[model samples]
Target chain A: MYQTIGEEIQVAGLFKKGRFWPSKFKWSGQTFNIQKITLTAEANNGGVKLRYYSVLASGNLYRLQYNRQFETWRLMEIWCEG
Target chain B: MKGEVGLTGLNHCLSDYKDCWAHVDINSYFATLIQQENPALRGQPVGIVKESGRTCIIAASKEAKLLGVSTGSRKDEALLLAPNIRLIPAQFDFYLDATRRLKRLFESLSPEVQIFSLDEAFINLTSCKYLYRDTHTFGTLVQTKIKQELGEWVTANVGISWNRFLAKIAGETGPKGSITSINQENLDYKLATTKFTDVSGVGYRLEKRLKAIGIENLYQIKLFSNQELEKHLGPFWSKQLRKMSFGEEPNLFEHIDSNPHMKSVGRSITGYKLCNNETEIKQILYNLVLETASKARSMGLAGRQISVYLSGEGRYWFSHVTLPSYVNQNKEVFELVYHYLYKKWQRSFLVIKFGVRLSLLKPETQINQPLWPTWHKQRYLEKAVDELAQKYGLFTVRPASLLNGQLIRPEVTGFLGDKSFQLGS
Candidate 1:
């Protein structure tokens, strides 16, 4: 199942090879460690360009968005296996 | 018809390609991305539909394909083929984003690259071929970099040749994750072994046409003159076939990339379920107008001709009108479509699908006009609304009419028409 959850969250990551690699994130009073980043892409909402990282953790997929202009992180969506 | 042939201008026979181009085709792009994101789906049959309850599959996993569940297969047919096939909604944004990343990697490898579609790209290796020992070395470099930068599960086939035509064919010939190269030395052999249908432009009907003319392979076209081919095919195809017979990339084939000016901007949708209410149907039409107009506006294009289509319940309503002036804003296009399309439908039962198109487009930059007071006021109002949309989100502020029913969220098409709007939305 897929869920659209646009909630602001806290993310911790490492800067490697001139790119920010998100290692973990906190959402909904729980912490999920990112096992791997499957893909990263930049999208523009109106004029605000944001970067999204698709990460796998805890047997689920998370789409995390980062707006560089505001220095904020938003949890965009999640895919959970049933 | 002359200029319509496409870029690199004139057509002539060219010599063999010595590692001049590389075509990278991401195998089962949408399905692979899904598998990459969710490991549980890696070994299973997967079908990607537009949304829940949507019957048609836009893409299928290699497993599903092997089971005869190809793209365009209905959900019912897919289940018949693979009972346990997992049907997932397509994540267009994710797929597009992945393509962008791949494009960046290709651009880094070579200064010139052609993104044919979401899953395919052609990189001009002419300038950089001197740095590599052979096409295999360069192909391996591309594969290794892809695994390192994208993900281990993401894989592609690489084809290297002198031009885009043969390179793409070579990529298609190889198994997944393999590199295939064709040159003058093996050109005839490759053409002899490959079916005409394997070529990009050749479809089932065209293949039948070729076979009807006693032509079975690409090499046979060379044996016949363009005049003889023209007797079977048209003037255009005869010329195109002559070039393709010699492993030449036809300029006409690159029309989309060569022509930046779009002829039309349109939007179509198949609703979750059929609706019969007049108000509900009108809401959908208005929604489509918003999408079409916004796309044209984003592309800085305005159209003088507008067309609309509605089909369902054993009835069809199609209409088109040439406006007094070109229009690109939502207000103008919506008002016109409402008058020319929706209001004109004498009767309605149910609407399963509908579409709106703006054609005869011209660049907004080319339109120079003296501003009238009313027009100036409307333009300012539109500018204000666009600012709000851009600052907040595309649908953050919508017309009050859209609130009458459930609003349809914006969706992008697989064929990346009006890319500015697709990528932005």
Candidate 2:
């Protein structure tokens, strides 16, 4: 099952070697620990840069997007394993 | 005939049962791709259209298909068939990117992989038989890899046979996420049951022709003798159908390495917002020229003949001009197209579609120097700009005029209609 969660979230992570790696995030008043970052990609739109990540947390896959221009983070999607 | 006794001749016959060609076709490619990206859409009825305003459905998901919605169905028909169907516009960039990912997966399995279309491919797995016990195992492995790498929702039907045509038929006939094979032993039975229209190259026109000749199935093709077929159809088509009936591969498949010289390069834009004036139309033509020239240059070819066309309100206008020397620069092509349009300028109904075609192509290496030496400087400068565009992006450096006009982004498409992946914005 997949659901769209276009919500802003609080992320606690470390910026190591010029890369931001998220360990956990609080969304919808619930905290979840990310197990791994499966994929990373960058998208540019009219000079605004956005970094996207497909991460695994609590046996579910979640898509996280970081807007470098606005300095905001969004939880775009969630894939719940059935 | 005496000179054709080599690998070329061997490829035409099913001499080695161990060697096979595999055709992999994505099930409801566009619809499945959308589902793969958006998990919420999984198992839900969906239809993909050209755009929001467009009514025709280009693809329908399996769920939608169950409700009698299918490709080519109108929006009204689809909605009537499945009231809950979700309609999404086609995203060419996302589909192209997915195709590239599929190609990479196929290439890892076999060195000889030909992309048949945006969503289909043929792989030669003759050398890899030893690695897998049978074709079924090999097909399963390929499917598993695609699911693991691309997405869990992406599935394909694989067909294995001694030749490409039969492999394609097998794939089409098989259920999704399964592998089917047609061999020498089962070829005749399969053909006997299959409809003529179901075959690869047979279309409605050919099907009607075959029906007139009392032929309704693939097996019935053998009922007519070559002379009889030649009398009814032409000699070329007669021979093609006869060969297809026996499951013989065409000669062109043998010499696939030889690239045919491109006779023309063209691009057309349709279903876009109608342009209101000549200036807007010229702007669109300029963008088309840029794309056409880039395509010609990519193939290391240049064209001397240029043609422009505008069609709308059930009317069309076309004009062509042959240049003194072959050219593949954006400026040269744009100027020629603009001049032709300028000469034929007339206020007409809104221009809904337009095209630019460059013909009389010759290898860039074979082109002769122009009479004026200054042209050489322009050519060198264009080459440098092309390199930069190729590296950074196509839109990185473009004509200043294009900024004011609406331009359709040129998609990276292959000669065979395969599109390059457009990643990263």
Candidate 3:
């Protein structure tokens, strides 16, 4: 199942080789430790570029979106596996 | 005499069946993508609309389809049918991204993949047959790879056949998430039962004509001679139909070129809002001309004939103009459109859709210098503008009139081809 949660979150990651790699993020009183990056795609929202990451954390997949113009992060989706 | 063989000859041809092409068609493409994006929406009554709670449904999920809500259904009607139905606005960028990922998967299997649409592709697996023992094995591999790589929700129905047309039919008629093959053995039986209209090229007009001549099924098409079919349908169409009916590859299909020259290129825009005035119509026409011209220019081709069409409230109007020289510039095409609109300027009905078509195309390298001095200057200026637009982006440079106009931004498009994501955007 996937849930839509458009909530701003604090992301702690390193910017290596001009790309942001998220190591972890705190969202809704819970911390998700990133394990691997599955897919990365870019989208343009109202002329502002946003980088979306489909990452695997704790054996579950989550969609994290980072706004380039606003310099903020938001948790977009969570794919929970049973 | 040998080429004129009938049922017996067709049966003999079955012994030489060879799997060459595989058509992969995504199920309920846009709706499936929406469901895949949000698993919560899966197996639910979902209708994808251009706008939430406003526009008609552009695509309906299988759940909504089961409830008799389909594309072009009004939002009110959909709500009445299924009150709990979810209407999601279309996200074209995400759909295009999924298409790209699917294309990559197809490429991993075969190098000769032709994207028929954003959700369908024809891959020639003739050269890669040695890698897999049979077509069924190869088809299974494709389905498994897509599910594992893209998503388990992203399923496809694949059809394997000797030609593109048969493969397409098999894909459409086959069970969802399964592989079906239409070879020479079952070609005659399939054609006997399949209606002529079910075939791709046979539209309503053609179906009516075929029915008038007592041609109802695909088998009837095989009985007609090429000359007889030509008299009924046009020469080119008759030849294609004959080839398809006989299970013989057309010349174009046999010698499939990587980049074939297009006979015509066109695009149509159907907006949710209505255009009630001439100025508004012209603004939309200008935007369409820009798109058509950009597409032609991108293909390194120029057209000598331009056609403009406007439709609203069951009324349709069209005008065609022929230019002295081949041109692929927005200003030139817009001038032709303006001339037509000036003569037929009637704000009677609210315009819902407008389109522009460019035909009689020739290679851009064959263009000759115009005699008029102003045209010469205009050509150079347009060339520089096109170069900048290609490099930076289409919206980087635009006409001053479009600055205030509420025109939709044109995306990267191909002539008679699928919409692809622009690189470096």
Using lDDT as the measure, the top candidate is: 1
Residue B247, candidate 2: Cα error in Å is: 1.2
TM-score of chain A of each: 0.92, 0.90, 0.91
lDDT string, candidate 2, B3-69, tens digits: 2222111112222456778899888888887777655578999998876567788889989988999
Which stretches of model 2 miss by more than 4 angstroms? A1-82, B1-18, B51-53, B251-257, B260-263, B345-349, B371-373, B380-392, B412-425
Q: What is the lDDT of candidate 3?
A: 0.73
Q: Looking at model 3 chain B, which ten-residue stretch has the lowest summed lDDT?
A: B1-10
Alpha-carbon lDDT, every model: 0.80, 0.75, 0.73
Ranked candidates (lDDT, high to low): 1, 2, 3
Question: Model 3 misses residue B137 by how many Å?
Answer: 1.6
Best-to-worst order by TM-score is 1, 2, 3
Q: Please give each candidate's TM-score.
A: 0.89, 0.79, 0.75
Of the candidates numbered 2 and 3, which has the greater TM-score value?
2
Runs off by more than 4 Å, candidate 1 = A3-8, A15-19, A67-76, B1-19, B223-227, B313-316, B347-349, B419-425
How good is the docking of model 3, by CAPRI class? Answer: incorrect
Evaluate residue B379 in candidate 2 and report its C-alpha lDDT on the 0 to 100 scale.
78
Model 2 chain A: which ten-residue window has the lowest total lDDT?
A: A39-48
DockQ, structure candidate 2? 0.13
